[model samples]
Target chain A: MSIFKETRITRLLIISAIILIPIALSGCVSGGSMTATSWPGVTADESNLYIAFNQSVFAINQDNGKVLWRFPVEPEKNQTFFAPPVLTEEGELIVGSYNNNVYKLSASDGHVIWNFTGAKDRIIGGSVITDQIVLSPSTDNHLYALDLASGNLIWSFEANEALWAAPMVDQERVFLSSLDHFIYALDLATGKELWRQDLENAMVDTPVLAGDLLLVGTFGNELISLNANTGDLEWRFKTEGWVWSSPAVYDNNAYFGDMAGNFYIIDVASGQQIERAQMGSPIATTPAIGDNEIFIVTEQGDLYARGLDTAHPLWQIAIEGRMLSDAVLANETLFVASLDADNLVSAMNIESGNLRWQFAPEK
Target chain B: MWDTLILDPMINALLVIYDLLGNNFGLAIIVFTVIIRLITLPLSLQQQKSSMKMQDLQKTKRWKDLEKKYKDNKKKLQEEQLKIYQEIGFNPMSGCLPTLIQFPIIIGLYQAIIRTLAVTPIQLLDLSGHIYQSGFFSIPSSLLPLTSNFLWMNLGQPERFWVTLPIVGLFGIPVLTILVVISTYYQSKLTMATTPGDGEGQGAQMTKMMSLYMPLMLGYFAYTFASGLALYFVASNLLGIAQYSLIKSSKGSNIDLAPVKKSVKK
Candidate 1:
């Protein structure tokens, strides 16, 4: 026999093996580290730090990290929160969720005030509450402005891409950076677009406002500065990796970290790198500034307290889980939120980097 | 090992083609399949030659005699076959090798489609890591949301029944599963039809069953998995048919589905 022969059984077995192996292997190769499970969005009033994390919002006591209250008080299917809660002047705590709803709860206790399910997609970004309207940007590519009292839709401004970041309200203009690679500034009252500037790539952070300067970081590895009122380009600073850490403006410099782990303090107007510090991991949120200390948290759960002016590390500490949310400063303590499974929020002493208190959601 | 060896290269290659083909993912998959078929043409030819040689050997008097003499003692029949196979310097498993090699490519291509589509943030971040830095085939920032909207379908979604198509209106008829099923049937039939069913050790029986079973199995996959994978299946089966036809024509073999027609072989 001058040929190769295979049994029909062998062919069937080999084909079955071929089919089964990849299905098994492909399961392992799926995007496993799919964004941190907990992205702690933290905001503070004078007495308590309100955090939206892991489907529930909590108002932790500022003096001692005890859970004042937890929203829903029960778990509901598909209702998870990653965006931090915002406190309105009238004391309404507004937070967004993966379940395509913006929940309004009483800040004093986690009681359901109202729910805004107008946004067609999940509300991942923090909602901006003004005198009359509650503006929430959603993954559905629309920024919904609801009446603050009734939770009714005032109007909606649509973008070409998913709106992953909260809107920046500066005076009469509301600025929003979209994952569609455009930053739109709209008239606060009418929800009419004032100007839209193309940033060339998706931006997932809220645009930072500093007087006339508006800074936005893009996944395209650039930090763009635009005139707050006009939405005109002021300066563009290119980074080594994606500028995911929203810049913290202080004095004359803007401090931020790129996805490549390079932390920089850049002069806002000059577009010059003031100082560079190696953080060794991707920074998740904007640097929080309080009492001369600049708080920067990496996605790996490391927190570094560097001097706001000199960009020198005062102290650095690692939390149990990844710190994906902005840290709130209340008095002498830094309130850090963790996307970790066990701990929800931890408060650390500002100068010493010591653990003050840890707040865990009741299981 | 899968990522560095197979998936990374396939992803970069797909992104390159996607960029070149006006960022149309469907066209990119088709062109990529054609290029892959062209590159692996030598392997297919070698495998086809080996299969034809096996079929011819089975039809010969010596093989029939061996089967008759060792009708009860299967071990003796196998020893005789191995001795002949060694004497001839021909390998039966060689035909299986190319197909075994193709398993990774097929799986890698499936994964690459999903990764390039980048439906989630982490998926996009993963894609960014695998991107080719060179200008030859790079996804520019302008193509941020590489719209999976190809031929009226979101390639990342399942091929729907067209009743809920208004929700997926960007896509066309969603006939990818049907096309895959049809192409799979033809491709399988082309191979099974060409092979002479030597009525030895249930070979003929298995071949007859496969003509129906394989298409349904592949169609089941096409119906459930991402439409992009279904597109790959349809493209791959069609190209396999064309390649088989080319080989058959070159060898002057009869082109017909023997069981279906009942006239091509018997």
Candidate 2:
């Protein structure tokens, strides 16, 4: 009798291979197959909150969490938006997306006005506006400056690595950091380089200008303070984890956290670790600095309100969802986008640490 | 468990190889597959030894006698086969270990190739979560812009459909897949057990069927998945052939899967 001829072992092996191999092959095309949704990031103005939800850019009433108007009235394409849909001085809603197109919509009524398709790759970084130009960095490794009015390409500067960080624009020069470890200061008009300096580590967050000192956090376990004009490194403070959190400076101290959940208060000039705090998990989102307190959220979804100087939390609340985007502080309310909680975006009283209203997309 | 044990390490290793080999993902896949083959060499050798021992047993007259004696009693045939295996000191489970070990690596490498070639925002965002955030092993983001373009194909996409420089693309295109099918055929032919003197035995028939089946099975995978996976399959099969040849060199064995191949007699 042969092994393959009417044998149970052969039957079992064939059945098992039929079952298991397909299951393995299914994992190969894992994206966009399941009903799972990407998380949302929120930005708020006086009366309304703009949300960059998966496949849609939406505006909601700030008082309550009711979704006001959704852009694309109907989603025609399978595009996704993760960057916070920022509002322009013209009060227009402009957001970049996974589809590699930047859309400008009416804030009052969500209708497409102009769409820019200049980027070679998907836009992960939100657009920064300076002097009528919309500066958007894309995974295609190019920083694109488009005329906000005409939606025409102003100029584009190619970087060696992907530009994941949003550009920090000023009057004379636009400051941008790249995954390629170079912090670029370019002429705002011509997209010509003014000066470029290598940071020695991947800069994930935009450089925060605090009194002419550019404070940039890196994927390599360090926070570097550079001279805004010359792009000279002032000092670098090492951390135990990757400093992906974009920092905020309040009263001469830079406040940020690392991948290890170790929060820091670095003296800007000295580059010294003056104070340190700890959370339960990695700090994925930037800290929201208010007048009196700081709101920090960990990747594990624990939100903590702490004093400007102290290492201990004033109050901490577990949102139980991942928060990767920075918290938006609109007046007294601090709106935190909580991912994985049915696409939740919640507002809390910054002073009281009490939940104000929670918005989840209606299924 | 999959992330910690298989996916993360495989991703890191592949990334490191990419970094070392000028960020070429296709080359990285080949190197990584070779490394995996090298690491599993001992297990592969044991399985080969076990399979070869089984083939030797099948080529004996005693096996034919046992089959004839227990032709009517099926349960007794299984029992007798077990007794023969015990007496011959061959472990059947050893024949399974090589295939079993390969399953996770193939799945992990497939997922890794797809994830690393993230062209969309959501895919890149998902990739960010898996990347090394800190430590000495942390890869510089400059090591990105992973070029899947190798000799004739983009490892990120299927080679069967990609258009290119007409003739070179036509000939060199999906060369890896062709090699995968051919090597699979050769590997299966060299590995499967055979029967005694006559080529008419059922064992020889099973071996012949398997030799045809394996190439088609592996070829289907090469055609469907990303070319990077096809490259890995080709590399693994080639390495497997080399190992088989090296092991057989010590004691010369017939390459044919048929029962005791006879000389050409016109």
Candidate 3:
């Protein structure tokens, strides 16, 4: 009887490992392929960091620069991905592909727990994983709500044009922008349209919710903050180029970059431009805040760590390739991935801007 | 006359229906299969008549004489076969036309699904942006974005263990992938055709190979495509069987129920 019990326990452990191994291995690849062109988004949980490149999702060990697993979304050769991966409160990594699919993977292992397919169009926007629902926008001009656990579609909200902005979910409401020149507020539970405010230009950046005001940027280079509950405009800040990067809200200050390589720090409450810093390259990547420092990457492959109060550069590092992905902050270490350098994920010491370690896929 | 006027419109109408129902693509495919069967009723009847006529011609003494005369020379065989067809006032192309038409339509549907359900930045630009923006079911948005997962597939990514569901489910038996492979194999067998003088033994061997090959290829694609497309394929196959049976019944042929059977005698 003792031997039989031991055998049963061993079998159970093996079976469990077999089931969990793929989930664990889902985020291992670090965008190693030569053909992969972009690493637009990277997010992290407690243990793993998720990066999106081409059609694959990579999960990296946050402690050490090791890959845990990789999930390859094999779209047709012509398709390309641009959106970042979003993490849910319950640890679901939600991402969409150019092949019109929104996927829910186990954050721990990268295993697909569920998937939603879009109409015959690409899903360029990253998914927004809320507490109970996952909101994804698609080029199919639709916003889809999926049950995070079962992958069952709860509801969908349609727009007049393509939806390229990642959704922002707060409480029971979800805010989204579309290329149709509109900003929309919808009920997260049923996907019911609450209100739509016309922006008159394509809104591609994910709206940043600061307190009760929601700040959104448009293709026309105008940044507008609206009341999150009423969709009423609070204030607007204009820039020289299109604002595609989502605004980073920190310490009552809203920080964002534009296509012209200019970073603007605006007061969230008043929409006053407090300071503007030029990075000499297009500021396409979002800014990351740490202590008194603000980190921004440019499309020309320049990284700048600037002081938030003084608007002066603390350190600047010029990597080989353009930095398209947002910088991720974990503790004191800042991680940046770039598409130009064969999608390499590099870690920089946030204080000194020193190269700590980098992980490149083995060819 | 039938191909241009009736068949084309019917196929187009069916495609419209596919767009309507669930935006849930898989369900649309099943509906398409049923509609295709209904549209090809006349051609199916003609095919049955031609098949029966060919079987009768095979038993005739005149056919045997022609076969003997053409036995050695391939060119002569072609001449004699043409002569027999001419004498019977039969056009072989007529019987084959339905199958040929169906092939392109099926391929068109597949291409349409792949092109329309794009999920990337580049692919989104390539798709007909106008159609993607069209609303369906008063959903206040385009009908294009729907979840593809029915059981265990993301359907849009290459099927790899890293992204799919864990192998075990419901009683810890791990039945999801098994169902995918088995259904695909059966679907391939049902859709394939048998050619004559494809020696019974050789034909069986070829069919077996084809059955395995087609399922594996589709399974691989299903793993890579959005699960919606896979659902469409599965639904299309099952619906295709129903369509085939309906066509056979309407034509009053001795419906085989099984896939085209190879002759027992080698």
Interface RMSD, prediction 3: 22.0
Please give the RMSD to the true structure for each candidate, in Å. Answer: 6.4, 6.1, 15.7
The lDDT per prediction is 0.76, 0.75, 0.65
Once superposed on the true structure, which residue ranges of model 2 sit more than 4 Å away at CA? A1-39, A73-78, A309-312, B1-26, B52-72, B108-231, B241-266
- lDDT, residue A240, model 1: 75
What fraction of correct interface contacts does each candidate retain? 0.20, 0.12, 0.00
Q: Model 3's CAPRI class?
A: incorrect
Give the TM-score between model 1's chain B and the true chain B. Answer: 0.81
Off by over 4 Å in 1: A1-81, A85-93, A105-113, A318-350, A354-363, B44-61, B71-74, B134-139, B156-174, B177-229, B244-266
Write one digit per residue (lDDT tens) for candidate 1, span A262-284: 88889988789888877888776
Looking at candidate 3 chain B, the ten consecutive residues that score lowest on lDDT are: B257-266
Instruction: Tell me the tens digit of each residue's lDDT in model 2 across A1-363.
Output: 334332334335545665676677665553342222344667788899998877678798988878789876766455878766778998997798877898888999888899999887778778888788888899788999999897899899999877877888878889999877899999999999989898777676788888888889876678988899999889988887778767888889888998777988889989988888777788866789877788888878888998765645688887857787789888799888876676478788887889998877765
**Which rank order by lDDT, best down to worst?**
1, 2, 3
Residue A144 lDDT, candidate 2, scale 0-100: 90
Candidate 2 residue-wise lDDT, B1-266, digit = tens: 99878888877788899989887888888888888888878877876775666666666666666667767876766666666556555556655666577667767877777777754433444665677756888766555546667887767556664446756764334666678899999887776532121346554555567678778877877876667778778888888888888887667333223231222111
Candidates 1 and 3 compared by lDDT, better number? 1
Ranking by TM-score: 2, 1, 3
Question: For every candidate, how close is chain A to the native chain A in TM-score?
Answer: 0.88, 0.92, 0.85
